[model samples]
Target: AQSVSQHNHHVILSEAASLELGCNYSYGGTVNLFWYVQYPGQHLQLLLKYFSGDPLVKGIKGFEAEFIKSKFSFNLRKPSVQWSDTAEYFCAVNPRLSGGYNKLIFGAGTRLAVHP
Candidate 1:
């Protein structure tokens, strides 16, 4: 079994401030990690994913994440955040299972509030 964790329950940032959201997961074998965002009243959406290829991947809205397999971490970063960036972010993992089905484990989301 695997679990996901997000260190911050809430974060506040001023416009143009840099942001980093910590995330960690416990899993083994080939795995896919992801970040998802949900605005106040919007559906959950994918921010970024790390299935393979480059460990550093870029995502929408100037978000990026680095996959560190050894540490089991996939922290999200945004160099400069804006007021519109306020949202709840969730980290999830899909560890490849020997069985045919794959399960997605999600972390308790971090709510980010960016002030103007």
Candidate 2:
């Protein structure tokens, strides 16, 4: 079955550190990529998303993701991260289906711990 993969299981960083989390999917067709973050005791929030326009999509909280179609990757990046950025980051992909309703497949998720 098609799935998403996050290379980093856990990442520890100090405040203002640069961050990059690798995310790859196993599908080769048209897709919509997304980055979701779930903070401690908080609901999931959309960090960034990529559809049909730009390959590089910017999302909330200073987070951005580049959709590399050739590599089948949509890696999330941040030039500087703050302690408040501590959360579980998940990479999700929605493969285009016949009926235009496809369930999102998410990665195992990368737990980010930012220290002050």
Candidate 3:
């Protein structure tokens, strides 16, 4: 079955450190990729998305992801993470069907802790 997989369950980092979070999906069709971040006590917010055009996508707060269709991967990255960046990150994918109304499949999520 098609699904989304997040490799990291937890990630700890210090301020100013670089961060990389791995995400992979199991689908062969064209997909709409997305990354969402949920703060400590906040609702989930979109971090980035890729539907067409360039594969490298940039999101809020210096976050970016590259979609590698060949490997079915869309890894998120941050050159320098801050304490405020601590949150739960989720990777999701929605394969565009012929008709409409696609469903988003989400990964388990990765909890990130950034220390000051």
Off by over 4 Å in 3: none
Regarding lDDT, does 2 or 3 come out ahead? Answer: 3
> Please, what are the lDDT tens digits per residue for candidate 2 over residues 24-43?
99997899889999999999
Would you list the C-alpha lDDT of every candidate in the order shown?
Answer: 0.93, 0.94, 0.96
Q: Write the per-residue lDDT of candidate 3 for residues 4-101, one digit (tens) a residue.
A: 99999999999999999999999998999999999999999999999999999999999999999999999999999999999999999998987766
Task: State every prediction's TM-score relative to the real structure.
Answer: 0.96, 0.97, 0.97
* Residue 37 displacement in candidate 3 (angstroms): 0.4
Better of 1 and 2 by TM-score: 2
**Clash count in backbone of candidate 3:** 0
Candidate 1 lDDT, 33-110, residue by residue in tens: 899999999999999999899999999999999999899899999999999999999999998887846578999999
Could you give the C-alpha RMSD of every candidate to the true structure, in order shown?
A: 1.0, 0.7, 0.7
The lDDT ranking, best first, is 3, 2, 1
Superposed by TM-score, candidate 1 places the C-alpha of residue 81 at a distance from the truth, in angstroms, of: 0.2
Residue 11, model 3: Cα distance from true site in angstroms? 0.3
